[model samples]
Each structure stands twice: as C-alpha cells, then as structure tokens.
Target: MNGLKGLYLEDLVVGQSASYGKTVTETDIVMFAGMSGDTNPVHLNQDYAETTMFEGRIAHGMLSAGFISTVLGTRLPGPGTIYLSQSLQFKAPVRIGDTVTAKVEVREIIAAKKRAILETNCYVGDRCVIAGEAVVMVPSRA
Candidate 1:
C-alpha cells in the first residue's frame, strides 16, 4: 500500500476483492434526486411508482451503483485509483431500508498500462441488485 492508503499497481492481483454496504433511506433518495437531478417519479413518487412494474418507490439505480464506487475508491485498489470506465446492469429494485452490499474483485491487470479490470456487483441480502465491470488506472510503484 502507498502512503495514501491505496494499493499501487504492483500490489494488485487478480481475484483480490473488497466490499462495503449501506442501507438506502428516504433521506438518501431525496438527496440523490436533488444532487443528480434524477427526480424520476418511479424513484420519488410512491403513487406513480406503485403503478410501475416495481410496484413501489425504488431507490435510484445509480445510488446502488454508487456503492460500487465506494468499494473501489475506499477499498481494494483504493484512494489513488482513477476510474477509466464502468458498465452496469440494473438487475432489481433497491427499496428504501434495504442494505446494499457492493463488492469489487480484480479480474485482470495490464502492467504496461498500470490498469486493472474489475468485476463489480451490488446485492441486497442474497439478491443481486446491480452487476457491472470497471476499469481503473492504478499508480505505478516505479
């Protein structure tokens, strides 16, 4: 690890993983809507959401996906890592009060580019709510 508390490129290995979790809340939903300007009724209006396929207000998919950022930025390759790209698939609704667990595992590393590809996923209990992949650039020790 570096002094910044992040793994240097040389320190990472395929299959290494880390995770973090948070419970979605009304405050979180409201605040996210404000910050992201994603006030979609399905996420904020219970009545409208009730008519949707999910049948009730659901937390923003991006909010659950943010948990993946938390894992990559604060754990695993950590603080100094720079995100190159991410692709996510929303698998299920994340309801208020559901605890979402985000996990990221290193899948590949390119030494010349000092980059890593990771498998990212978020779960509510045993049910997967989000699945994705991320590519990040890690600082080189040399």
Candidate 2:
C-alpha cells in the first residue's frame, strides 16, 4: 500500500470518497480498552453491561470512530493529511462480531489553505453507527 501515492490538495474533487471495513472483535475491544484506558463496563464487563440498556457488552464508540481515521489516513487524502477537527454523533451501538464500514466523502475544499472538509460516517450493515464531519489539512506538492 505504501507504493501508492495519495492525492495532494489540488487533486481533490468535491465528491471524492474512500472507505474501509473491519469486524469488531473481543480482542479489538480489549486492546482498545487497554490502549485508551477506557475500561468502561459497557465495553469490558459483560455482566455489568447486561443490566444496562445495551443488554450486552458493546464496543466503545471511539473504537468505531477510529475506523474513520483509518480510512482517511490510508485512503482518501491518504498519508500526509493532517487532521484538524471532527464532530461525531454516536447513533447506535457496535457489538462484538459486527462488521463496520467507515466512509468519508469530500464536501468542501479550501485550496488556499490546502484543507478539506469531509462528511464522515460509519455503518454496521444497513444501520448507521456513527455520523460526523472532519477537517483535514492536505499537504501540497510544492
């Protein structure tokens, strides 16, 4: 994948997009928990989570959001892009074994600043799990 070159600021189109998918797994949950120190029972303790509205352990919302980061870093504007800001709404739970697909679409461009505003979304099957927007500073070829 490193052999490929990502788009520079001047190359982007308004409707450009990219996506990637990953299946949420127990290991992923645990690893993300350890890495992020988000040891919430809803994500770590099944017995504790069972009594909650989820009724079962669910993956951390941020973990699913990371998929959106992966798509941006590895695809769309690709490498060299710098994340500026993001706003996310967690719409649904992502349970273990669920396959989530993260997608990003270019919505606006600031050529002078070499920046882009993208509409980001993550879906579990037909249901949307996360919705958001991101601003990234795409590097130029100068």
Candidate 3:
C-alpha cells in the first residue's frame, strides 16, 4: 500500500505511457490454477498439452492478464486506483518459459470525474498476447 508514488490525479497526462516487466514462472501458473480451480488438462498436464494446438502446456489467460493489474497497482496509476471496467482480447498463447512485459498507457482523462481511460497490453518475446483498455478511477489529489 505504501509503494504508490509519482502518480497523482493532476499528474496524469492523456496519451502518456507506462511499462513494467515481470518474469512468469511455472509456479505462477500452478498457483493460479489452484486458486482459480481451472484444472484443465492443457494447463495441468504437460503430456496432454503436448497434443493440443499449442503443442505444450500454456499459461492461463487470466494469469497473463494479472500482470496488467500488478503494473497498475504498483506503478503508473498506483494505489487508490479503482478499476471501473476492462475490455480485453487474448491474442496469443504463453508458454512456461516466456517472460511477459505488461504495459499501460493513459489514453484519455476525465478531470471532472477523476477517471482515466487506459490502454493496456501484455507482450511475450515481441508478440502481444493480451490487449485491452480499462476505465479506472484515480482518487483526486485535492
């Protein structure tokens, strides 16, 4: 909670960009699997996944997306950020060895409403796996 700094209501600029990096590990996938109860064979069974279109076990869509939240919570918009809504598209598959870089950009700011519209993206080795926009409420500095 104390980690949030740099970002305040008046400091945000529309069209500004922010980025954060994270390395995804197998443990992250396994833990998310246990917590979300999505034990699909493709995510849990390497052998089964080898036979699927991906040809190997892949990370969960939501797990990859969660990195976006991590970036939002810790950087850019920071704490007191309330997620109003998200529109996303899962565009590619993420394998266990991949390191994902999640990015968010401020697209529009509603100064009157203390809200910001952000464009979000997740990339794995140059390929975009998730892209979306989120409407968030950032507490006014005043």
Best by TM-score: 1
In the range 1-142, model 2's lDDT, one tens digit per residue, is 2635677988889999999999999999999999999999999999999999999999999999999999888898898788999999999999999999999999999988889999999999989999999999998887
Task: Order the candidates by lDDT, highest first.
Answer: 1, 2, 3
Per-candidate Cα RMSD to the true structure, in Å, reads 1.2, 1.3, 1.7
Give the poorly placed runs of model 3, Cα more than 4 Å off: 1-6
Poorest 10 consecutive residues of model 2 by lDDT? 1-10
| Segments of candidate 2 deviating more than 4 angstroms | 1-4
Model 2 vs. true fold: TM = 0.96
lDDT of 1 by residue, 39-69 (tens): 9999999999999999999999999999999
Each model's TM-score? Answer: 0.96, 0.96, 0.93
Order of quality (TM-score): 1, 2, 3
List lDDT for all candidates, in order. 0.94, 0.93, 0.87
| Ten contiguous residues minimizing lDDT sum, candidate 3 | 1-10
Displacement of the residue 4 alpha carbon in candidate 3, Å: 4.5
